[model samples]
Target: MSPASDPNARSLVQAGFSSDPPVSNPVALRAYRLARLRAELRARDYAGLLVTDPINIRYATGTSNMQVWALHNAVRYAFVPTEGPVVLFDFHGGLHLSAGIETVAEVRPALSWFYFIAGAQAPERAALWAREIADLLRAEGGGNRRLAVDKCEPLGVDALRREGVEIRDGQEVCERARAIKSPDEVIAMRRSVAVAEEGMAKMQAVLTPGMTENELWSHLHQVNIARGGEWIETRLLASGRRSNPWFQECSDKPIAAGELVSFDTDLIGPDGLCADISRSFLCGQVTATVEQKRLYGLAREQIEANIALLRPGLRFAELAERSWRLPETCRPNRYSVIAHGVGLCDEYPHCGYVEDNDRGGGYDGVFSAGMTICMESYIGEEGGDEGVKLEEQLLITETGVERLSRFPYEEVLMPSRWL
Candidate 1:
C-alpha cells in the first residue's frame, strides 16, 4: 500500500511498530484480523479464544518474539474474547516488544507452568494458571463456559476442564479465520514473494557445477535474513538423484552439470508472509537431459491444468476430483495435496486427492475469494534418478485466481510450447 495513503504508516515506523519495511497498513491489517477472529469465535458459539500456538499469537496480536522458542516453551499467549478486551500475555521483560501496537488492548506478564519452569510443581502452578483463565472467562464470558484454545498441554486442558470450562478445538477456528486474507495481507504476501524471488534469482545466477547443495541453499537464508524476512521453513534444496523421491534435505553433496536441481522456497519472507514457490533449475550452463526436461514438462503441465480449475465458490471435493490426473507411473510419489491454504505458514483446508477418501481424508468447504493457496506439483517415475518440484502461490479473487509467485521457470528445461 502507498505510504501516502496511510497517514499513520510513517508514525508507526517512528513508534517502532516494526523495524522492517512497511509493506501493509498495520492499523487496518490488525483490526481486520481481530474482527475476523472474533467473528469466527461467535460463529462457533465460543465465548473467547486462548491462543498459545506462537503462530496464532502472531495472528492475534501482530507481535512476535522468540516464536520458535515459544512454540515448545508455552511461555507466551493471548486472550481474545468475543466481546471484550484483547489481552496479550507476554514473557517477562517482553511487554515493550508490543508497546505501541493497536491490536492489543492490554499486555500482562505471562504465567509459565511448563515442566522446565516448575518441574514437579508443574501441576500446582497449572492450577494457578487455570484460576487466572477461569476468572477472566467469568468476567468476560457473560456466563458462557465454552472456550476455544488453539494449543494447550494435557495438564492445562485438564485443569481448565476441572474449572468447569468446556474446552473446544481452537485450532480449527483459527484456521478458518486465517484462511481469508484482507487487502493489506495480500499486499504483504506479494512483497514476501518478491523477496523470495530475489533470493532465487541470486541462486540461479551463482549456480555452478561442483557447488554443494548446502552452499546453494545458504544463498536463500542469507537473502532472507539480509532482507526483512524471518526464516526458511525447510532445507528442501536437492540435486540430481537426491531430488527424485523429494523431501531430501540439502547436503554437502556437490551438484553436477545437466542435473536438475529442484527446490521449494518455503520461505517466511518479509512481513512474516510465506512465499512457497518451487522450481527446478538445470545446474551449470549445460543442456538438460531429455528425462530432466520431460519431468519438468509434466510438472508444469500439472500445475497449469490444476490452477485452471480454481475459482471462487468451487467445492473442494470437485476441485480434487477434476484436478490434473497424475500419470499411473507417478501416482505413488504424488504430492500430499493438489493444493493447500497458505498464509502465515502452510495451513488448513488441505486439498488432497479424491482417492484419499479411503485414508479417512476428506473435508467439504467452498473456496472463497480472499483465500490464498499454494498449488503443488511433483513429477518423477517411481525409480527415476531425478524429480521436478513446481508450485505456485495464488490468490482466490472475486473473479478468479491471481498468480502471486512470479519467479521464472527454467527456460532451458521448459518446453517451447506450454500452457
Candidate 2:
C-alpha cells in the first residue's frame, strides 16, 4: 500500500481528517475573560483600564494581527463601571474603516461626537491622548478611580505619568484570568495537538540514515504547514553527539548508523492554541553505550507515572518532585520537569519546577477542568551516546486527565533497508 493508504503511516494524512471544522466565535469566551479583569479592577477601585499587550488585547477584544502600538491615534478600549459598551479611541484612519471586519471591540474613533483632540505632531499627539485618558477618568470620578495599565513600555509609562495619569500594573490580574482554559480553548488546543501528532508521524516514516539533520527539519516544517498550522513555533532537530539540551537547530551532520536523533517541534493553530512535543529515534540498528530497549522502557514508565499523578488539587511543586524521582526509580538522567501548561504561549504557567516565579509559582491554585497541559519525559545516560525523549499533550478534567495525542511512544529504529 502507498504511505497514504498504509494504516501505519506516520504522517498526519493517515491519522485522520486534514481539514478542521469552523470554530465558534471566541467573542463569548473573551467576554468572560474581560469580566474577570473588570472584577479585579473594581476590587482595586480602578476607574478604567488601558490594555496594551498584543496578547492581552487579543484576549480582551478578539482582535489579532493589528497595530497594537497605536495608543495615541486609537483608543483600543476603555472600561467604565457597570456600563457595558467600552469607550474606544482609534487614531488610525484605516482602523476606523476596517473596524467592522477586524475586531469585535466597541470602537470609538478620535473623531467621534465625544470630546476629542489631535496634536499637530507625533509627540504632541501622544501627549494629547494621555491627557484625554486622564480627563475621561476625571469625568468619571477620577479622584476615586484607579487606572490599570498593561504593557506600559517604560517610555510610554513615562509619558502617561507626565500627563498626570495614575497607573498601576495589571500583569497579575491578566495572567490570573488567562491561566485557566475554557472548554472552547481546550477544543482548539486538542486540534493543535492533533496537527502536531500528524506532523510527527509523517516525519517518522521518511526519517532515515544518511539524511542530514537540516533535511529532516525541513520535512517536519512542511508537514506542519500542510496540516493548517499557522506557524512552526519551534523546530529543533539534533542528532548523534549534539542531542543535548543546549544543542538546537539542525546542522549538516549526517546521522550515523547507530546514532540517536531527537527532535522538538511546536505547532500553533489559527486560534493561537499551541502544542509542544519532543521525540527521539534510532537510525539503522541498536548499539552499545545506549540500550534502546532499556531507555525506551524507562521513558515510557516515567511518562505513565507522571500522567497518573495529574489530578485536581495537586500542587505543581509536588508534580516536580514526582518527575525528578521517576528518574531515580526507572533510569537515571531523566529531565527535571516533564510537563507544563500550554496555551497562548509554550511555557505559560511553567509547571514542574520549584521556582517561585512565573506561572508555576502559586501552587495554591487548584487544577481545574478546562486546563490543557503537556506531559514530557526523557531518559539519557552521561556519555550522551544515545537517549529517548517522549512527550504528549493532556487535558485536565473534573475527575482526571485525558491524553490528546495517542501516537506510539515506543522507540523507533528505522532499518537501513527501508532507508
Candidate 3:
C-alpha cells in the first residue's frame, strides 16, 4: 500500500512535530521567500523580473508541482516591482481542486493574477497574452524596462524576444540569495537526514551476501516509502570490484562474501530539501584487505577534517583542495570531486578540485553561515577495483559545524556482527 494509505505511516509523514510552539502559517514562510526574491530583483537593478525555474516557482508560489505549465507558454513568471504585491502568471483552474489546496491567488489577492489561457496556441492568442502581460507591467509604471529573467529555457526566451521583451541574465543574483538556508529550511533538511538515517539503520539489519544490487536498492526504496518518503534522489549500490569511485550507477551484480559494498543514498523531503550520504559494508567475514580498510579510513578522516574547518570567512575552494589530496593508500580518480552544496538542487555552486573558469572554480567563494553542505570524500584503485566512499551532511554555524546525520561509519555492520 502507498504510505499515505497506511495509518502506521502518519508519524513518519509528519516527522517535524513540535508542541507548545507559536502556530505560524506556512504561508508566512512562503511570503518570506517572495520578499527575498523581490529584494534580489531590486538589487540587480531590474524594474520587474520573470522567474521561470521550477525551483524558483516553488519559492515564489507555495504550490510545488507542475501547475506552472499552464501559464499560456508565456514563461511561468512572477513580475515584482520595487514596491507592491507581486503579479503571478499561473493556471488556477483545476489545480486547486486537484491538489486539494487553495491557489496562491486566493491566499494573496493583493497581487495581480492571471489564469492560464484556455485554448490552443493560435499565434493571435499568444500575442494577445504576451501583450496583456506586458501591459500589466506598463500599467505598474514599468515601460520598456529591462527585466531580469531567471532560468528562462531557450524556447521561452525566444518567444519573449519575438514579443519585443528585453530579458537579462539574473542567475548569479538568484544563486546568491538561494545559497543560504533559512531556519525553516534547515529544520526541514535535518528531518530529511533523520529519515535517511532511519532507512539506513533498517538496511544494515537485512543486508547479507548473495543479494543483488537491485534487490538492495529495492529494499531501500521500500523502507523509505514506508517512512513516508516520496522519492529517492539516487540509489548508488556498487559491490565488490564495482565499489570504485568511477562506478556510480547501480548494477545487477550479486554481492559476494568478503567483498566491500559501497553505496550512496541521496533522498529528498516533501519540502524539496535533500540529504546525501555514503557508506560501505563488508559482506561476510572481514578480510585482510589492508588497502580497502586504509582507503575507508582516509575518506572518513578527510570528511571529519573538512567539517572541522568549515565556518564563515573560509573560501569554498580551500576546503575542497584540502580534502582532495589522496593518502598513500589509494589513488584518486579524475572523475570525482570531494563534495558540494546540497539544497533545492543536488549540486548548487558546485564545489570540488576541478576548475571551471566560467563558474568560479575551487576555493574562491567565501563560506558563510546558513550554508548546508555535503562533505564527501572517496578513494578507489586505478583499475576499478575495490574502493570506499564516505559522506555526511553538515550545517555551517557561526561558531562551528554541526553534523546532521550521525549513523555509524564503520565497515562492520552492527546488527549482524559481520564485517
Candidate 4:
C-alpha cells in the first residue's frame, strides 16, 4: 500500500487545517511538468538537455533511483531531446529494476564509474558515456551541435566536446522551467505542507524543558518520512543561545524553559518538492521576557511585510528596494534576502537586500503568476544573545498571493503592545 493509504505508516494524523485548497490530480501534474520543461528547451534553442543533477533528472524524467547516491557521485544521467522521449542512463541497471512511471522512452545502463573492482580507467568510462550520448544526439536529429548540460565532471565534459558537442548551461533551463508552478505542482507542495505542519503540531504537543534538540528534531523527521516524504535538506533546529546567530542546526543541547527554539524545515516531501518553513517556538509554558517578545515581533513584522509585497508583475529589484528596512540596532544581523522562489527546492530568482542592489549587483526577475516563494527573516541583535527566525511559503496567484504554510506562530512570543 502507498504511504498515504497505509494505516500503520503514519503514527499520528492531526486535522485542524481547513483553509488549504484542494490538490490537483497527480497524473495531470506529471504531464504538466514535462510540457513545461520541453517548452523551456525549445525556447532556449537547445538540441537536447543532458541532466546529471539528481533533482533536474527527476524533474525531467520523474525517476528517483539512487537519487541520494547521485548527489555525491555522478552515477546516473537523463537525456531529453527537444521533441523526443526522455532517455535515462541508469546506474547498475536501476532502470531495469524500477517501474516506469514517468515519460521515459528508453533506459540504458550507465557506464559505471566504480573502477576499483576491475582497475578500469576513468578516461575509458568517460569516453564510453560520451559515445552513447553522441549517438543519442545524432539519432535525435541534433542539428545545432549544442547540447545543454546541467552537471558533469570535467572528463565527461571534455569527452562530450571531443564528440563534437558544445555543452551549454542546462541548469538555467531546468530552473526557469521550474520557477512557475502549475496547479498540480501547487497541490503537491500543499500536500507536503500538510504533512510538515502535522509534524510541527506533534512537536508542539511534546515540547518541554530538558528535551534535547535532537529529540525534538526527530519528531519532524519521523512524521515526514512516515507520510511518504523523503529526507530533510538541513538540520536547522536549535534552542536558546544556539538560536541567536541562526543556522546552528539541531544539536544535543537541552531545551530550557522560557528559552526560544527556532527551526527551518527544508524537507523534500512526497513528490520531491520541498516544504520550506521556519518557526520560532517558546520552550515549555513560560512567559517570554520583554526582550524576547521584541525580537520575535520584529522578525514577524519583517516576514509579513515582505510577503505583503508579493504580487504578479512585481520586479525582484523593486521588491528588494521596497523590502522591510531593519532598524539600525538590528541591521548588522539581518538576513541577506527578504524572500526567494521555491519549487523543487529553493529554485531561483532570489530577491536580495536593498543594500545588495545598491552595490550594483542583484538578481532581477519579474514576478509571474504560479510562482511559489518563501519569505524569510532573521532578527538578532549583534553581540546580544538569542534571536527569532520566521519564514512562510506563498503561492502567487493571478490576483494575489496565497499563504501555503499553515504552521501557527507562538502566541506567547508576541509583544504585549502588538497583542
Per lDDT, the best of the predicted structures is: 1
Residue-by-residue lDDT tens digits, candidate 2, 1-419? 32355565654454543435446457656666667677777777777667655456656655544432443333454433323445555444635543653234346554321124333454555666667766766766437546777765454566678867777766666666676777777666766776666666766666678988888777666755676666665556787777754246779988877777787677665576777777787766455233665666666666778899989777776776655455443334545455777776654455644443354443434566667778877667666556667787888888999877766653344223222
The collision pairs in model 1 are none
Candidate 3 per-residue lDDT over residues 1-419, each given as its tens digit? 33234454333334443211232355556666667766877776666666656566666665554533432343355555545545555444423421433224422211112233333444444455556546655665356456667764454455566766777776655676677777777776766676676666556555678888888777667765665555676668888777775556677888888787778787764466576888887776566366666667766667777777778787766776555466444544632555577876564556766444234544468878888888877767567577777788888888778777676666443222223
lDDT of 1 at 330: 92
Q: Which of the two candidates, 1 or 2, achieves a greater lDDT against the reference?
A: 1
RMSD of 2: 6.1
Backbone clashes in candidate 2 total 10
TM-score of each: 0.94, 0.77, 0.79, 0.92
Q: Candidates sorted by TM-score, descending order?
A: 1, 4, 3, 2
Q: Judged by lDDT relative to the true structure, which candidate is superior, 1 or 3? A: 1
- The sequence of per-residue lDDT tens digits that candidate 1 reaches over residues 1-419 is 22223453233233222224347998898898889899999998999999999899989889999877888899999988999998899999999999899888899999889999989999998998988898889999999999999888899999999899999989988999999999999989987887777677767766889999999899878777887799888999999999989899999999998888999999998768899999999887788777887888999999999999999999999998998899999988887788999999998778898888568556679999999999999998999899999999999999999998777677789876862
Better of 2 and 4 by lDDT: 4
* 164-260 per-residue lDDT for model 4 (tens digits): 9988999999999989898888888888888788777777767889999999999889888887888889999889899878778898999999889
Query: What TM-score would you give candidate 3 relative to the actual structure?
Result: 0.79
Worst 10-residue lDDT window for candidate 3 reads 106-115
**Window of ten residues with lowest summed lDDT in model 4:** 10-19
lDDT for each candidate structure: 0.87, 0.62, 0.62, 0.82
Top-scoring candidate (TM-score): 1
lDDT of 1 at 49: 94
